[model samples]
Target: MSEPGKYVLAKPIGEAEIGRLDLQHRMWLTQHHGLYSAPISKSSKQRVVDIGCGTGIWAIAFATEHPDSHVLGLDITLPQPNSAPANCSFAVADAEGDWSFATEPFDLIYGRMLINSIRNWPRYLKRCLQHLKPGGWLELSDVAHRFFAEDGCSEAESPMLRWWRVVFQESSRNNGIDIDDTYKHAQQMRDAGFADVRERVFKWPVGSARASTQEEKVIGDLQYQNLQVLIGGVTETAVQHGDLPGMTAQQAQILADEAKRDVVENSDRHGYYMHFATYVGQAPR
Candidate 1:
């Protein structure tokens, strides 16, 4: 478990966070090219569970795609549970806490961006393994949370990078949840008895100013907006959990403002992109 005050919802459970969560769902679709990339069945009897289903967008979409299948979306809290398909339902549950709410095995189990939220991944993967049907499929995703310059423009480093490093990397390190472990997810899944694990990397460009095509521009715009929300949310996290000593709120804000400006200005320059990855694996029959 994280420190008493370490884990915090970046934004409260309200309209603003609801908007961000919904936008985040849409952004991932563009990044991954679909609602799902795993080869899970769309059979009428198929059963799926979306771990950490925020607003139930993914669950609602999946339920629509497989009307005969029952889809359960689980999260600690959902801001506004939209009127979902008859096959879809939402429940308030913590993935890191008791998973007793799950009564039976599932055909496809999906988790995404949870590496940032959950603490004990090995145990979580083990629980996922135990809860899966024989030969069930599992798909997971996470953000690496660092910027990269497309061109050799290392001089374009910004305080945003520092803040990111402090909050996600250093803080996670302090809390024993190294965020950099994102790269080892496939292996971890394998260690947890998952088979045929594969990891696919993706890039999120920060702005559309340097996009070469229309699709790229659209994705860029979405990603830029994501960063804007992220910046607003994570700045406090950095101050609180980042283990940065003697940093005042005023100091942090000044640094964050300059960092946002740098990100905007540098976008027109060499261009920076953030990388994330999705892992697909299966339980052995």
Candidate 2:
């Protein structure tokens, strides 16, 4: 059961999480062309909803950047001692549950890095469709569970892949929400009646030491920083499911550390990266 006024979430929450999410917001901006992937015109007055808007960083930034737009950030819990622009506000909500908090239709609904707790893709997307104005857009972005290496980069895969697999993919399934099924979200969106669905995939490097370009090096370093935070957060969850339950927290963290180390020490050799995909679809006019 979740706390009163809190959405049931798999992620651990705290001050550290807030900082990591803010960092992730910055990292995402460095990786993407803009705050979001969908092509919404700047001049048009818009109503935007950010699902799983951790720390309200993205929503706050989006509202501040596009002052003409009204951006509302939604999550299971809202941050305390938080402040936002006049056009930006936040509320507590679970995307899988009640959306009645959104009194009116939205022009754009965006969800970022929230593939873990969502169980029903098509149903949830259909709900998003129902909440959208005609021709409105839906955008979702997340990193998938594969860590790959290019030719001459490394002969073996990074052990970090194992950490992601067991912690996110395997453990999520044990709780009845399969993170791997995110690959099917685009098709599921189409089945839910979205139109002109498109997906963009980018290879996001794991560590800065091996990147060929300066920009990539910066992003890679950011990625490494985020991974360290994630490992610390997920260690307990990793211990709870799969073959790891009953292990001490320190033991679980040890495994997580090993994986992170492999990424740092072997980034040059492994060319370590995972696929970061952004899915975009529009409600029918």
Candidate 3:
């Protein structure tokens, strides 16, 4: 269990491996190519650390693919795994801590979708730098914008967009996160003395005719599902902060229903887009 005041529970990935969670994982894999791609150079003897590794899926995959490499997943939560490869291990660690377990430097460090949970980007980048071996790689990926919609599909006047903006802004404000920005992670890497920085952006077209298959539809579904989790918390915060009029529970439900339709209709009339950006840099040898 996570200590009191921790923003999240410190359980293993297995503990959180529910069906919806699995769907999110698959969608993320599809959305972020770098998560499982050839772009990453692998040395058999290298050590890799996955920061904020939830459920240890990515860590386990890396361990399976590179038998000689060591993979460690550190998170506040550790899912109880049916089995983990000999090369893979999961531990409880807070990203804001000293990272005391990493006595030696790691050859690669990875973090994904962690912006909303972190307060200080520069401090986090500095800590990631500290755990890296000379010439080690650091990769950071996150959603640049929330609730993307096609140009003029959902106008500023659209209730769905208005609800989303208010919900996201208030929730992020309450959580000490800057949701509007976090895309400039490349700049953060450069400031941390990392070199050879590169940034890649991927677009997950949601609710658009542009998506040609069921896989795309599944992605859209997952986006809406995850959005549901944030909506309540965000709206509650807005109401409490006096930023929004207190909406009845029914009103919340109606907004969600409308948003779902907007997402499921393949609205060529308008489309939803999810922005995924990744920044990769190398620590100087």
Name the best candidate (by lDDT): 2
- Candidate 3 lDDT tens digits, 26-61: 565655422432134545797888888887877877
**lDDT at residue 9 of model 1 (Cα atoms):** 13
lDDT per prediction?
0.72, 0.73, 0.67
Q: Estimate, for each residue in 189-268, the C-alpha lDDT of model 1 and write its tens digit.
A: 88999997777776667788777766567678887677777776677776766555667777777767766777767665
Model 3 misplaced stretches (Cα beyond 4 Å): 1-21, 32-41, 153-157, 212-254
- State the local distance difference test value for candidate 1: 0.72
- As a TM-score, model 2 comes out at 0.82
| lDDT of candidate 2 over 10-84, digit per residue (tens) | 222234423545556655556663566676655548999999887787787778777888999988998543667
For model 2, what is the error of residue 175's alpha carbon versus the real structure, in angstroms, after optimal superposition?
A: 2.8
Q: Which order, best to worst by TM-score?
A: 1, 2, 3
TM-score of 3: 0.79
